[model samples]
Each structure stands twice: as structure tokens, then as C-alpha cells.
Target: MSELPAGLHDDQTNSEPIVTAHSFLVQQADLEREAAEVLPGKFDECTYDKGYIRQPLYACLTCTHPPSNYQRTKPDASAETAPAGMCYSCSIECHTGHEVIELFAKREFQCDCGTARLLPAGEGSCCELKSTRKMLAKFANTKNSYNHNFWGFYCRCDTFYNPDDEAVMIQCFICNDWYHDRCIGKAPDEGDYEDYICRECVAKHDVLRCIDTTLVFRGVVADGVDRQVEVVDAEENKAENTEERPSKKAKTSACRLLPDTVSQPMDLFMVDGWKNDICTCTGCIKKIETQKLEFLLDSDEIVEPEMDDTRGESLYESAMKKLQGMDRTRAVDAASAYHAMSIKLKEYLRPFASAGKVVTQQDISKFFDEQKQQTH
Candidate 1:
């Protein structure tokens, strides 16, 4: 069986939907079957004991009081301890109204009486901290940081985490934050994943394979001596790539410019002349490569596996010797997306292609554009 590339693996997402751009190609029944195969069982329901023991941050279920370790005692003569604790809202919502006993700060756990289904249904039974959904059994706050909004959890981007069932999300092994696959520009194919590390961690280590190859090495040949040299001057290296194209002078600017589509008066200016120009930067080159891969996948052309390209592999290995810690994780991501697109595109456009008419580029482009819009 083929294995996922090193440093790239699928997350254990439980019952959450795996959102892919190509999902529209599959039937609803087929998706449900796939989900069943991966999940095999229902999502584990959250409980008071589980949340209090595991989660570091939590708020009262009945009220808006901030998360605390105050535990309220049961009013019965037996003096049995309530499983959880509550905040100010829990008192007004049910505790005080029900003549519940005073709360004593228990350093170990919070008040869980709210989770026992003690309060009668109505205004008092509703929890201010959680959703009004009828199925919610326990209150939980696994968020690394606190936020007053409905989205309690936070992504690595430092933004509130919003769950979108239609967007594929991958969990980072280092930070444990979930990020949408598209946002990261790296997504896995349809398969079980066991681990993953975010780009931020990889970037911080300065190991990402994103170097200007043209500026690397330039040396004179010597007699009987194989000499390796490192070039230091940035301008000297930059000029080497530009010397051949003296007539095609690139516009030099101190600030980054944006296209007219995105307007920001304070920061960016619309550069109409440079709009059509192509960038040969390392990042842009990778973008072009990914786009070409996408194009090939959409066209139903054969996408040769990267492993089959010996020459390219040799070059990659040579570059890795020069640029240490380079991995095939990005290549694996690209390949996965390519294979998925190829399969889904072929299935979706088979009818149109077999209708005795030539399918044009516009037809394919428009079809995918519509599909992407629908997903959003």
C-alpha cells in the first residue's frame, strides 16, 4: 500500500465532515458510506467529568460568569457533592431559584449540577455558555484562549475558530490547532491520516524548500581540484538572473502593490502595467507548478508520479544537499490534490465529453469555478 509522505498525515477528525472541493462529484449516499467507513461509530458525547478533568478553560453552563473552579454542594441532607460547578448565571438561572446550597470553591473541580438535568425546562434550564441545541449534554471549553464570541476555539492564525462542515480542516501536531486545508495551501487525499505539522512550525525552523535556486552557486573550474563556493552578495546574485533580460526591466518599488480587485487606500496602489507580469520568485514558481498540476488534472491527462521522474528526483536530492531539511510533504500534497481532481473531474465531465461535442477550456474552467463557488 502507498504511504503518505513524511511530515504529512491525516487528522483523526471524528464525526466532522471532510470537506473537499471535489466532494460535489460524489453522491450524498456515497459520502455517507465513506463517512461510515472512516468513523465506524457515533461521536463520543462530552460529559461534565470529562470536561472538568481534561479541559483547562471552561465557563459556567447556565450563566455568563467566567470559568472558575467554584463547586456548589447538593442541598440534600446526605451532603453528596455535585459533580460540577457553575458561575453567577447558574445561580440566577437555576441554583438560587431552586433553593440550591451555597457554592464553595473546590480547587479540583467546578460545579456540575447544571449538567445533571436538575433544572426544569424553560428560561432556567437554558445555558448561557453553550448552544441552545437540544442534543448538547455537557459544557466544554478546549480553547487555548478565551473569547466572548460563539466560536470559543482559536486557530493558529489567532482568529476565532469557526467550524465549516464544507471545508476540509487539518490539525497541526505541534500546536493542535485546526486549519482549513485551502488556507494552508496543502491538503491530503481521501485516506486515513495519523499525524500532521503546520507550516508555521516548519517555517520557524527555517527548513522549508523555498530558496532562489538561480542565486546559489557560481564558480571557476580548477585543475585537478573540485572546489565548492558560496556566494554572499545579494545584488551580485540578483544581477546574474537579470543580466540576460536587460531590455525587460522590472519595476522597482519599496512597497508591495495589490491588484484593483482588492482596494485598500492606505497601503496598496493599483499597478495596472504590472498586472499581467509573471513573477519568477521561488514562491511564485511553486504556485505556477501547482497551477499546472491542477490544469493537467482537470484536462484528464496522465499525471506521472513524482517518484517516476528520476531526473527531477536527482535534482531535488542535489538541492536538498545544498538546502538542508527539505522534505517531500508539499509534493505529496500536490499529488494528492491532483489525483483527487483527476478522478472527480473525469467522473463529473464524462457525460459532457461523451456527448459527441468537443469540451473547450471555457467549459472546464467555468464548471470548476461554479463548483468552487457552491462550496463557499
Candidate 2:
């Protein structure tokens, strides 16, 4: 302390040491400035929209038995995927134990693996021959277009037609079936077309003769305005029956369920406890599920791929290049600072990776700016 050591020269005139403890502070500041310049949000970026997704074709995945009389049970509350799109036969055989999802007749997809006919012949064969009706077959074969006519246009003339058919067919709201204009005694454009019924159902149900008619619905979710059930209590029914017999000439509209929506012969029968509730029929319920899937697909909610390491000049590379002209120790210090900054950028981007969001170069630049602000 009294005298300087051999290699050290004490100069009262210049007191500052050659290498100070905070000497690298200037290098670190330069690094942050350069980082701001080099790595502005530099990651790959993409945005997703639902309009690009495709609607799938018709399909079923269920047991194939004859009389196909049974319907699938309601979906389980805990299950993520709702079981829809099964045939009456499939509901009884393969899916009896599991909660059954409602099924709709799809326009494009064929029967899934669960169909009896699709199963191995020895293990599970179709108990009854599948329907060979030309219209039904045509509808099942539809591979594209998801319009209302996806089920194929069947005319009472025993012929299947398309939208391009020369003869315009009118759809009977009663049966939700199409009939050739000529078959229903209608001209191509001329007939009181407001309301119509297929000749078959009209005759079978004696629709015109009955003053009061009731539609017994099954598998219908009573959600929208079109699907609410009109409940007539026993007392109300008796009171209404005794009150009035309307004039014979007055037209009595037939009572229909879920008008303007898909209806099937199966809907004619009612299931206990389903009255005044939503229609949970396979077809209707599947439609609901399909719409939801379509929305999710459209939203582009999936995670994106990770950013490549070799992408344009990385922050580390830039730092190395900037520090090359400096002293070895200073270069090493700058590189360490750059490494710390890179680690921070990675940490910030980690959450995006988990969320399936794309991290781009622009994101990196923003991180640098934030780091620069915090350091200052």
C-alpha cells in the first residue's frame, strides 16, 4: 500500500484504471441497440379463416341390422365427440352399450367402419339387405354440394332427378319429399303451391277428413322457434273438442312438427320424456354437431409449426458480427449479453407455441424493443 508493485507504475496525474469493472457496460448497451435494429418481430406469420374449409360428405357409422328399429341413446355428458350419423340397426347392435350420438344422413361420406356391411363378413354381416332404392342410392352416392337437395330428388313418378332436370319438382312440406310437377297434377309453374302434401301420406292419414291431427315427434331437439312442441293438455284437448266443429268448407291445415326442417317417417312416433324437449334425433343432432365442427375448423384454432433456427440473420449472429471488431474479452461479454437476450426472446415465444399461434420475425423485434425498454 505504501509503494507500487514492480509491474505497476503509480501515476498521480492519471488515476483511472485501463480495465474498469463496468467496462463492458458500453458493449452491452451497443448490443441492445443492435438487437433492436436486427431482430424486430422476425417470425413467420399466418392468419386463418373458416371460409377455406370444406364440408364433408354424407356418412354413417353404426350397426347394420334389419328393421333397424332402434335409435341411439343420448350422448354422454363427459364425451368430447358426440356420436351422430348411425343407422337404426347400428344403434341396436354395436352402439347399444355406449352412449349413441345423433346421426344425420350426410351428403358425401359413406357408412363408417361400424356399419355391418362394412365389417368383416364372418364377424358381423348385414342382417338384412341394404335398401336398393335408386333415389336412396343416388343420395348416398352424392360426393359434393351440401344443399337441401343433397338427399337426392325423388319424384313420385319413381324416378330420381337433379336440379338440372327439365321438369321442376315441388317439395311436399308434409313428407319433405319431392314429387314431379306432373305427378302431383301441377304444371311447371301453375298451382296453388303455398301448401302441399304427398298423395301417399294424404291418403294414408286421411288428412282431409280429420278435423284434428297430431304429430308425434321423436329425436327432435326443441331449441329454435321452428321446433317447439305445442302441448295440448288432456283437459285442453277435451275442452277444444267439445267447443267447436268448424264449418265443413273451412280448410283445416294438417298439424305438422318442425315445419321447414328435415322430417322423416320415424318422427311420426313420439318418445316418452322427449315431448317439449329438443329434437335429439340422429339426423337433427348430427346437424348441430357438424355446424360446430365447421366453425372450429374455420377459426384456425390449431397450433402452428415451430420457427426454423436457420432463418434470416438471428440476433446471436448479428451480435457475433458486431462484436468481431472489438477486444476478445469485450466480444465475449457482448456475446453473453446476446445469448441472454436470445433466451428471453425464446421464453416470451414459448406461450405462443403452446397455443398453436405462429411466432414470426415481427414478434422477435417486439421482444427486443421490450427488452431494450426494460434495460433502460
Candidate 3:
């Protein structure tokens, strides 16, 4: 077996040992008996078993130990003197160190074998020790209560008022913090207390408060207003940074064919393959590419022709040729042909007006009257 350190000993032999292993066994048995006496059934015989002695010592001494290491030393005693009693466990000199002694004194308890134990117990152990323990327990309970009562370490006045009885807690949508209605300066006893007020409400309040100079001096709206203003300023700055100039292609593509003269203007004109052409705009481009594929998947069906300018033009041209070949009253035939042409022109211009073309009603009426006079 390894030899014990100089000051430490494991010796089992002694003619008359000042302190023996069995002494601690006896002391522990006595302590258990005392404890059982105070509170019946509180401690049993097995409580003083070897397992109990081996546990870490929680109590400290109130005085210093002697040099001999067998007993506690008096305050005025020198290192040459032997100690009165020794701690069975730690094997250190019996005088409780500063920390251990202080804990026992403050707690109003004494270690089983120490000079410090001589100090008179304050208010007695039953009152002082038990009260101290109760106070510590209450403090721990208060800390736990504070934790459970306040959510996210924040509580509104209303929430703190009836913390134990609140059925449903309201949480802010933004910031996700909880508050009582009364905390925000609102009456808690009012109807419909179930409503939740969030950071958004504060933000809106600040915005309104900022715009009103009266509320600005109160400082209540400053934080909220500043946040909202910062957001608006940031958005504006981003929009300015991302501003883009129109491309040359877009400007050139906007040009269109215009009328050469009012008399022979092309009222109805169509691009030959406009439906097949690909659109260039971002929104239209996607559909443009897939249009042909979509058309093929759903075969096109021919529908009956409606009376339109294109149909009117073909009918009027044939009628004019037949009118010019007629031999009886050529004047009347010319007059009738002119009237038919006027009606055809009106039909063509009507479609343009309906389509949002820039043609005035006055212009259409004037043109029709001129054509009628020419036929007469």
C-alpha cells in the first residue's frame, strides 16, 4: 500500500488513540439519534452507516486547530500545543479554516468537533438555522416566481397585476413580447380584454405622434417615429439607386405608321403576321414563345365572320363597279354609289372609335356630310 503523506495517517494500531475511526462511527450514531429525537421517524439507524460518513463534509468549524493535528486550537493557542479534537474525514488540523468556520457561524450551526463550536449560538440553532434555511428557500421560490411571471423578462402593468389568475396572455405580433393592457396606459377592466397590442401599434403610434409636433416633446413617439422614418428613407434610397434609363430598342419600337392625308387614311390596317411575332416585354415574352406550342396543342377552329370594316370594304367596292356600268339615270346611280360609300366609311371608322383610336365624333359626322353632298 502507498504510504500516507507526512501530516496524513492511515494507522489502525494505537495503545489509546486520541481519535479513532470508531469514534466518528459513534459520533454519527449519536447525531442520528439526536436528529430522530427532535423529529420522530426523521432518521433511522441505517442513516449513520459507513456510507453516510464517507460523504463530503458540508459543515465547517468556528475556530483554528492545534499543531498536533488531533484537536481544535484556541484563538490564543500557539503551534506547540496539541488540538482538542480532530475531524475524522479530511484529516486536517481541527481548527475550521476561515471559509468553513464562517459558514457554520453565519448559519448558526457548529461542527461536531471543533473549538469554534464554543461560540454561543445566535438566537439558538432552532430559530437562527431554521429561519435562515426558510429565508433561503423563500428567496429561491421568489426567483422562480419572477421567472414564471415575466415572459421574456418583460411584463406589462396589467400582466403583473393578476399574474396568477390570467387565463390567456396576449403576445405582440412583432417582437413577440407579452404585455398587459394596463401597462400601455389602457384600462384593463374594460370590455374585450382579449385584444393583443404589438410593436406595430407602437410604431403606428409613433408615426402619428411624430407628425403631430405636440406629441414630439413628450418623447413617447420618438423611438417609433424614428424607426418608421428610417425604413421610408431606406426604401427611397434603394429606389433611387436602382433607377434605370429606358433602352434605345424600347424607344425605337414605340414608333408606328401615321396617316399621310385625312381623305385617304388607312382606317383599317393589319400587320400580316402579328399573331406569330414574339413579344419583347418581360411579361409578354414568356407567353410569346409558348403561343405556337399552345395553339398546336389546341387546334384552331374557324368561326363565322362578323360584320366588320374589312367585310364592308369588299362589299362596297363591288357595288360601286356595278353602279358605274348601269345605263339608266347615271346621275342617280352615282348618287346612290356615293351614299353607299359614305355608309361603308362610317362603319369602318366606328370600329376604330370603339377600339380607343383618336378619332372625334365631329370629324366622322363632317366627313359623312361631305360625301353625301358630292353624291347629290
Instruction: Specify the highest-lDDT model's number.
Output: 2
Candidate 3 Cα outliers beyond 4 Å, as residue runs: 1-152, 156-168, 187-195, 199-201, 204-376
Q: Rank the candidates by TM-score, best first.
A: 2, 1, 3
Compared with the true structure, what per-residue lDDT tens digits does model 3 show for residues 260-370? 222210111111221222223443333323432223113233221122232222334646666667886985968877788867775756654455443444655887797
Clash number for model 2? 35
Q: What is the per-residue lDDT of model 2 for residues 266-318, given as tens digits with 9 covering 90 to 100?
A: 11321122222233344433443554422211232322223344334545566
lDDT of every model, 2 decimals = 0.36, 0.37, 0.31
Q: Candidate 2, 163: how far from true, in Å?
A: 3.6
Models, CA RMSD each: 28.9, 25.0, 53.5
Residue ranges of candidate 1 with Cα displaced over 4 Å: 1-46, 49-154, 157-166, 173-175, 190-192, 199-376
Worst 10-residue lDDT window, candidate 3:
101-110
Candidate 1's residue-wise lDDT over 211-284, tens digit each?
22232222212332324333434444445444443121233232122222311111111111211223444444
